[model samples]
Target: MELNYEGFYRFVRDELNVDLNAYKEKQLKRRIATVMKSSGALTLEDYSELIASDEVIRNKFLDYITINVTEFYRNKDIFTDFEFILRDYLNRQFKNIKIWSAACSIGAEPYSLAMILDKNNIKTNEKIIATDIDDNILKKAKDGVFKDFEIKNLDKKDLDKYFIEKENKYYIKDNIKGMVSFKKHDLVLDKYQKGFHAIICRNVIIYLKSETKDEIYKKFNESLVKGGILFTGATEAIYNPKEFGFKKISTFIYEKI
Candidate 1:
């Protein structure tokens, strides 16, 4: 039941609409193998066919590939820069502050933003809209519960202030939960929401083709309020900030101009 390469290519086009040719062969193969094993399928071919024909398997495949493995404050330095930008914007004193945590996995990124804003006393009618393509991860994010290890890297004082221990696991305080909206959004297929003061989409686009990245950035550009910020991963920003209607606000932050 090993996948026939030719048959796999056709399934890619018909089901996922992702041309395997665009992905690095070894990487794609490894991911398929991993999914096959996780799904208890005998072969990649069986897994692929199941995902192609079954709605449940299709969603499960998307969830698996979304690869929502993450923890709170995954990189502290990045959050340092993020805090600076958030404060500067807050200091400018807008009527409203709208932030998007695109591809937010298991609640960390948006919750991080929420914690920052709450701690800073950033005064405004402000909110963070967190979105991800996978419903499973979205549900997890909504739950706002994490293990102790997940928040270990967070600033100690901030951690104490924003989270509480309940039954030996960490849970985001009620304030943080009420400050953000969580939604299921497929950035590869869904329309971008507009007028965001900032978009944090770290490490989410590396798997996508350049054209898809560009298309998403174009949508992001339009969604911003002319001078809004865009945050990508340290290794994830490939498009020139200028051409994307953004100027480099920092090594990992972009400002729409």
Candidate 2:
């Protein structure tokens, strides 16, 4: 039998609680097919059974579909510019900043933000919220353990200051680890929390459908306080910021106006 993507989507929605419909159909289908094939499943229905029955297969399926490729200080130049904006602009504007690192894979992005905050001594009312749809990734994030490749972007100074090297792995220091709190959040379906001084959601939204992306941008705008910043990935710039109550302040950065 041919792949039953409609049935698979429903199965994923009802069982996995992930809305596959929100993602670009063609890209998602291609990714699904690739992962499905790796499981030696002839059909999507069989693949779904394997995913449901085997925890390893289930984790693999979720990890693959979510596309969680990330590292500390991803795109060094962009992060450097963002750090400057955080210290010079957002810090000056807000007394106690609230940041949300959406789609944070394995906690690197939020941890990077925490490092920036700690280095600058920026005070926050609460811990920085780092969220992802994948619970398995969230658990790894909470553990704060990383491989060398995952932290290759960090300079020696930051590495020495922020992490403790044990054997072949690096563990995030308690001080920095305390700065961020991890949670499970689905951007496509969950209600966004409001009054954030800055919302950093990068890379993930590019895979979503246009209408879904627009809706998410709207939600992100509403979630931020007036004059807050919304940071996007290098390739995910909003063509028209005004449509989302944003003003293009810099490359890949938007100010909620």
Candidate 3:
């Protein structure tokens, strides 16, 4: 039989319980080819068998496809803008705010928010919800350990205040770590929690298809209350925000209508 993507897609769906079809076709195909070559599999069938038999290979495949690239306060200037909005607007509007850091990778984004909340003394009724589809990544996030580079963007004062440096690795303080809660969540397949004062979902939907992106945006709009904030990635801006019941409040920031 000729090597084809359809069969590989089916194998992934059945075995992994992940919907590969939600991602962009070209990107998904390229990732599959790279992983297959790395495993020394000449055919897709062989690769599928290898993944099924080896737990490590299965995890490796999942890790590669999930895209866990993240850093604390990624895009510092944009984060400053978010801080301004949170302090000047959201905090005043809602007495006890609720925030969701969707597709939170390695706890950086949510922890970043936690630090902001701590520094500025923002009151939240509940812990910030940080979620990702990959269980292994979620485990690492819960551990709250980071290398020098991961926390490089953070300033010295915040670093000293929020993290403990031991053996050259920074460990998040329990106080800040306690502010955010990590959970396993698949953005495409899972249900979104509602009544969020602000939802930060950045740098993720760019890898998905347009329809999938549209679906996620619609769901995000639904998930937020009126006038709630939707902070998206720099590259993932909604050109026609009105269609999604949002108005462009700032660069990569939207306010729900």
Candidate 4:
């Protein structure tokens, strides 16, 4: 039986309340194939039946849709711009330097930001809340583990200062690890963290539709205090900001007004 991928998507939406239609088809299909291959379903209908009827399959679908690739200091330009905003944040905010790493897969981005704060002596008064929809990734993130290659882009001093090299891998050290708190959060259903100093939600939105991107951006804007910075990945940005109460801070940066 040939599975109707279109029908499967509709079932996922109406039954699960998860919008598979929001994702880019090419990417979505690629991920779906991984599950299908694992299930060894020769026909599309068989795969659709498996996906629609099994709760485990439903969770797997969410995992595939939300999991994404990341590296430390991904896109140097974004970090460079973010650093300037961090300095500004330090100057103005004395307490509750709350930051939310929405969709902080495996914790690289949040750990990287933690290293930056520790280096600048801003970690003392600051707090970072890292969230992901997937519990599997969140557990790894909470452990603060990383392979050596994950930190390859770092300079020698930074690598030495922030990471402990052991057993052929590197782990973010206590200084940075203590700076973050990880939790399970779904961007679609959860309320925003209020009055944060910054929100680094990079790369994850490319999987979402423009409407979702705008919806999340609006939440981010409302979550931030005046002058709070919102960082996005290169080639990923909110399609509009007036609706979100944010102003373009730079090419890939925005600040709440």
TM-score for each of the candidates: 0.86, 0.97, 0.97, 0.85
Name the lDDT value of residue 136 in candidate 3: 90
In order, what lDDT does every prediction score? Answer: 0.78, 0.94, 0.92, 0.79
Instruction: Flag the better candidate by lDDT, 1 or 2.
Output: 2
Off by over 4 Å in 1: 1-25, 43-45, 52-60, 124-126
Q: Tell me each candidate's RMSD, in Å, in order.
A: 3.0, 1.1, 1.1, 3.0
lDDT of 2 by residue, 1-257 (tens): 54478888999999899999999999998999898899999888788889889999999999999969899988889888899999999999999999999999999999999999999989899999999999899999999999999999999999999999999999999999999989999999899999999999999999999999999999999999999999999889999999999999888989999
lDDT of 2: 0.94
Worst lDDT 10-window in candidate 2: 1-10
Model 1 lDDT tens row, 1-257 = 46686687678667765445544456667787777687778866787778877888777777766668677766788878878887976447455778899989898889988887887777546568898877788888888999977887886787788888788898888888999899878776668878888888987677776777887888888999977888888687645877888888777888888
Q: Write the per-residue lDDT of candidate 3 for residues 1-257, one digit (tens) a residue.
A: 75478888888888887889999999888998998899898999889899999998889899999989999999888989999999999989989999999999899999999999988899999999999998899999999999999998999999999999999999999999999989998898889999999999999999999899999999999999998999998788899999999999888999999
If candidate 2 were superposed on the true structure by all CA atoms, what would the RMSD be? 1.1
Q: Write the per-residue lDDT of candidate 4 for residues 47-82, one digit (tens) a residue.
A: 767777887876676667676578789887778778
Among these predictions, the greatest lDDT belongs to 2
Residue pairs with backbone atoms closer than 3 Å in model 3 (clashes): none
Clashing pairs in 4: 2-45, 3-44, 3-45
Over the full model, what C-alpha lDDT does candidate 3 score relative to the true structure? 0.92
